[model samples]
Target: MALYKQLALGAGLAALLSTAAHADLSGKVIGFSQIGSESGWRAAETSVTKAEAEKRGVDLKFADAQQKQENQIKAIRGFIAQGVDAILVAPVVSTGWDEVLTEAKEASIPVVLLDRGIDASQDLYLTSVASDQVKEGRVAGEWLVKTVGDKPCNVVELQGTVGSSPAINRKQGFEEGIAGHANITLTRSQTGDFTRAKGKEVMEGFLKAEGGGKSICAVYAHNDDMAVGAIQAIKDAGLKPGSDILVVSIDAVPDIFAAMAAGEANATVELTPNMAGPAFDALDAFLNGGTVPEKFIITESKLYTPADNPQGEYEARKGLGY
Candidate 1:
């Protein structure tokens, strides 16, 4: 699987580099309406997006929506008024985007979605750049199922923001992954809002409700930040995180690796923060050569465990603004 990921990533990068060389975004103004820095991975994504824009000489106008759909809609309107060449949005939720997206389309402004997908029509945006969120969740679930074997296990899920695509899709995929595993039951699930503080608080409630963490066998967090927070909650309750309650999550952020190195987290699915690379590539093609890119440009999602050199992984990603 590692070799396959390397080959796939290499091919994708080669294609992107070729497209980038042929198309120039220099001096082009692009607006990025970001979902706020709610997690470490989100922060890394924002940092990488900025770096990619700088590298391509694109003038990037950024706005932080602070996890609010209204703020994002306002930012998009602001970008349209400025008549920017293109717009990028990491929507906070899937619904309520049709109206704003339609406005962008009517203005002849191509909008590309990042990370999370929206429930709006395909024609509303140029393309969506994101990982297969369902697959990430399934991978985490499969890991738990395999590790727990035939033993009966109770799992609790720490979900992302309510109504968000990641939270919904991930929850569905995890259920699918553990469908036939009769021994593993999802006992409780609740929203963590994809934040460390909220994750910790919700986990504390779960621990209290689940016999002080004794009944829970594992925790499935929608993101690494939540997993890290849950680990702290477990410690506060005088329980070993990885040993007492197996921790599995998506988004292979640096802190998650640090936890894995310390034996606090068991596994994570890698959700690369470089969604902007393909989004930028698509914009360059459309703007320069009038080429129409694929409607959905998917990125790779790989699973990581402690055996994958967690300490090295932690060091490698620690400097990427996460």
Candidate 2:
């Protein structure tokens, strides 16, 4: 009876604290600038963000940048003009953000970065919530190196948008991962703009240039959407994707897991869509309690393959607004 009484009291106190925290953010107006629905993971992030805000009773003003930096800048300025309490941005690109972020700071609106980080100074925003993107690429590359062993493998890379942080960092990290392995060579590389259509187009050209996909041993895409497109390109070229050319990418979206279940793809690194949860928590603390959070909050990056039960993953993530 004594233990039960203590447990009940602890539960009651925890509930009170949770309710107080929720009340601090209730009815607060927040502006979110998303980088458009470019991929499945992106759509999931937006959905989760909205659900989180609704749960917290926050009035969320959502903006889609449509993959343009100028549009994002315009939206931020609009949010500032509206005098929103806080602003969240998933920058379309890392550069070209100093001016608009400066404007937000001047207006006394706390800014939080979600998913991607900017190249500007650390003081420009309250904090950044993102995954270790370089490590994501390194994981994919390390998997390939282990899979192929000392075999001479010619790799073709499907890069993301030219100037995005994921594109730049993932490329550099993959290069570093495969540095000492002379047997693995990245022969051709090109930007797919992080789009499925462009990924297929670029891959088609790569197949033709590399002797109809005969010389290619692997294909590394910056994202799973591009990998899925590349898989189709390989199939159309009369080559098996996972068998002939090992397919590896990032952002373990549902469709990518489906591809892995069907033996179309090989591996992927997870970039979770719950970045908004941490971002909101940080905002709540900073806005209500004057508590300053860490400058960078990095989420986990786990590698997934067919052995990890791809079908189960596919089912679990199918309804996540992806």
Candidate 3:
């Protein structure tokens, strides 16, 4: 996340608030509720956010929700009790956020969402910092369509946890990308829970069910870690991954770039872990000058192909907590 991700309070009550002219955030304490280290990108996000907070002289109080809405709710309440300047959350799910957000609002605390969004009203939070998940899926889908040409292809999908915003929106984008291409059919679809181990296990099942990868042309995963696992599964099934079955997914983690350099994976859409940058900027502007920032701040969803210098990308992100 950077200054480029956010807009100035586009709509809603956030737009009506005036920005303060003076900015001084030193010695201010802030509470952050992370969605846990569920993926490589999430772990990196935690690392980056902490580093950014230190640079800004902001005391960052962190809480890991372990992917549970109840845990997140409890953490928010605790932050409210502490009366921190603001609260940041990377939601585990979309629903069940109204009550907690309302509580934050009542406390006069600005709540900022990171990475994923919740079903609660936009008025409840200051803003959300995230990437365009739907666009990520569309990019992967478009790449596969171009690589396969007019050849009739059957695709097997490894989706993230069921009902998650990324999973649902990514699937929608994929469908939109290949809408007119009847030759490309998503054959067997299943959830891999967005983990390397589960991705491998589910991919094995997909190989067995698809007649040993004979009918499947490509594999699309919701995250790069899953795609990496699926690649290993393809190899263990006595098949070449890059030539036998194409690989493409989202979340441009360091491992995914390594896979691309080795030609095991085809492409990945980046979900940058630097979301804290924009969040802190908006918070600073709001507190210093009463500036009402944009309700939604979107980060980049960059597509990295093998030709985009995979080895270079890998070296660049490896030390960044990926």
Task: Please identify model 2 stretches exceeding 4 Å from their true place.
Answer: 1-29, 35-41, 63-85, 92-108, 118-121, 161-165, 201-214
lDDT of 3 by residue, 5-89 (tens): 1111111111111222222676888999987775555677788778778777889999998877799999999999999999998
Best-fitting candidate, measured by lDDT? 1
Per-residue accuracy of model 2 over 48-72 as CA lDDT, tens digit each: 7787788789999999988899999
Residue 36 in candidate 3, Cα distance off native in Å? 3.6
Model 2 residue 15 CA deviation in Å: 22
lDDT of the candidates, in the order given: 0.84, 0.83, 0.81
Q: In model 1, which regions exceed 4 Å deviation?
A: 1-28, 35-39, 64-84, 91-109, 118-121, 150-152, 160-165, 190-216, 236-239
Worst 10 contiguous positions by lDDT, candidate 1: 1-10
Question: 78-112 in candidate 1: lDDT tens per residue?
Answer: 99999999999988777999888888899999999
RMSD list, candidates in order: 6.2, 10.1, 6.8
Q: Candidate 3: global Cα-lDDT? A: 0.81
